[model samples]
Target: MPAERLDKILAHHGFGTRKDVKRLCHKGLVFLNGKIATDPAVKVDIGSDTLVIDGKKITLQHDLYIMLNKCRDVVCANRDGEHQTVFDLLDESLKHKFLGGDLHCMGRLDIDTEGLLILTTDGKLTHSLLSPKTHVPKTYGVGLRDALSEEEKLRYAETFSKGFWIDREQNEDGFNCAPAVLKWREKDGKFTLEGENPALYEAVEKNSSGKSDCLLTIFEGKFHQVKRMFAQMGNQVVYLKRVKMGELSLDPQLEPGSYRELSEAEIALLKQRQTD
Candidate 1:
């Protein structure tokens, strides 16, 4: 589908607000396929064409997929306490643009545990990943108190799929827990698994004897979901890292407290979820 509006395209690129984009369009600052465009309503296919804004080529990354090696004591949100937020690490220009009412985070990761995070201005993409019905999988590297056993894996899965009631008063409504699809893999004193491997399923089930880290996937995004899930397993999550969300992965080039524009392929994956 061709992008029907210039402001939409600009917003998709993590440029700025719709009004701000419209202003740029009216000022002839936006270019379509290299030619100056003055109409905010101009239609263009983001996938096939190259867009340039103010001499900088803009690839309409429909949604942003960010991977942050979150440092301790930082929050994974746009705004928070004295501790810096994940958004604080982004480029000033990107911060100014996405910080506006136009953009938001797809899900929340605790301040302590950090890894892969997906942020975007596209609400539909956010919905697809956050919705319980869609079951978009998210993998995380977890730190545990002791080794995991075969029965623990079964218990973890059972508790995640059914639901657990949390006692904490973090949520105003009530402490209701949501179900998730949980699995863990152990590696070298820490449970680890590559995104690409054949025995990943079995690795999560194998019993290991040691205080180690584990990798797990959760299908739901509730308040403190990952940490709480581990709490139920009698394991404290000392560290956490999200590896994937749907078809998007944290860009290898982006480091801790850093972000970049999403590539064309990643945007296409997000757009594809609009229909399915």
Candidate 2:
């Protein structure tokens, strides 16, 4: 979004190599502001400059952001033993690029959990997203092991929106948490898991696994926070999947183990969430 070398901008936009851009510049094929650019090294304001190559405009893309639809049996850590990690779900090319850049996750889901995850080399963005001050809400699609009565569901909903206190392991005393947004959906389906819990995965659909599903958006990320909340409600979480984080949702097209690059607009949305 700042001023940069014309050729570098063009190359970054995937127009061509720097050498190719130089050739085009010299051949009067590249135009900027109705004038032919003779030097590829010319400085241009990418945010305002109108760049045309072979009679077409180009927009330059910056940075690399990834959206991963995480699945079970994979850890969120950089490296773990005897279990797959989120990085393993990436394409080899992405893995290499990310590792070389020292990319990291903004937040982590448990190895048995699945859903939306943002992986990036942008440290500032990652930190901002993870910061408590930002209060970026993360939404999860949860599967419960118990059914609740209408009266109980109302109590749970009221508790979720009004906030509550929960017990902690580190201290006998507990902490008060901010209210979260929740959407409930009753289900009679079986869960599908990889290696973490096979029995839950093997159960037949609509065969009374006795589970309820809900979508929850929490503003905080404590260790096993969602599980604790459900436990406090006298319910057990049998399966968990993250569906959204900030303004980014899990790409519906992506399979459990697949991932894809985020668009420039998507990146903007995420940054907006931090400041909003």
Candidate 3:
């Protein structure tokens, strides 16, 4: 990418328009590479140069690939009339300033669901990731209302590995979903082993009133698939959060409702296909 003006970078980060940037510059409020800034028109290296305003880091990237930590109550659509959308987590700066147009959400998550969501301007990448033929894996952290017995967990894992029948009432595709993977999790969605893991059903049985948690990975995109899959097993998902998509994992440092630009290495991981 080519070099960009300092004020433009600030404006692209939602610091304000060029005029506002000039004001900040004149007040000695802008700092470039730890030095006080006096000029707003100075050119900057988008990747190497760091810009700080009021002690906040300003990121300026020409190729935008955002990893948003979505929170509950937000829809995944580009626009929504009933509730907030994922893009709403971004500032007005990214829309028209940095990015030329609206950012597209690669995969859609339910309104009540939260966690990792990829937003990019690359159409081809989006097509490749979302296409059903690609069979890209998406992993979710799940919380169930009832504690699943050891047998039930085994059955669930087996059912996921082999294509299973969706309750006909929920889906009429006439074909079963592709094989998926399921694993146990602690209450906070951290991974644990099957036998050595105390968070498994065996531990839940001791309390008798605790909810069970697990991690689920699927290759297909179906409406209410994860929630409904468990429902068929006489279990209910009280909470759902997507933790991984394709080869990208949500950054733990990013808090809910916050987002960060994907590093170049992370971007490459998304395009790397798995081989058997």
Scored by lDDT, the top model is 3
lDDT of 1 by residue, 136-203 (tens): 77766566666667787778778877877765636533356666655554333434444644333332
RMSD after CA superposition, every candidate: 6.0, 8.2, 6.9
Query: TM-scores of all models?
Result: 0.65, 0.68, 0.68
Kindly indicate the candidate among 1 and 3 with the higher lDDT.
3
* Cα lDDT listed for each candidate: 0.62, 0.73, 0.76
| lDDT of candidate model 2 versus the reference | 0.73
lDDT, candidate 2, 124-172, per-residue tens = 7887788888888877767788877778877898999999988885654
Model 1 scores worst on lDDT over the 10 consecutive residues at: 203-212
Q: What residue runs in model 3 are displaced by over 4 Å at the alpha carbon?
A: 1-62, 97-101, 169-174, 186-190, 193-212, 274-276
Error of 1 at 27 (Å): 9.7
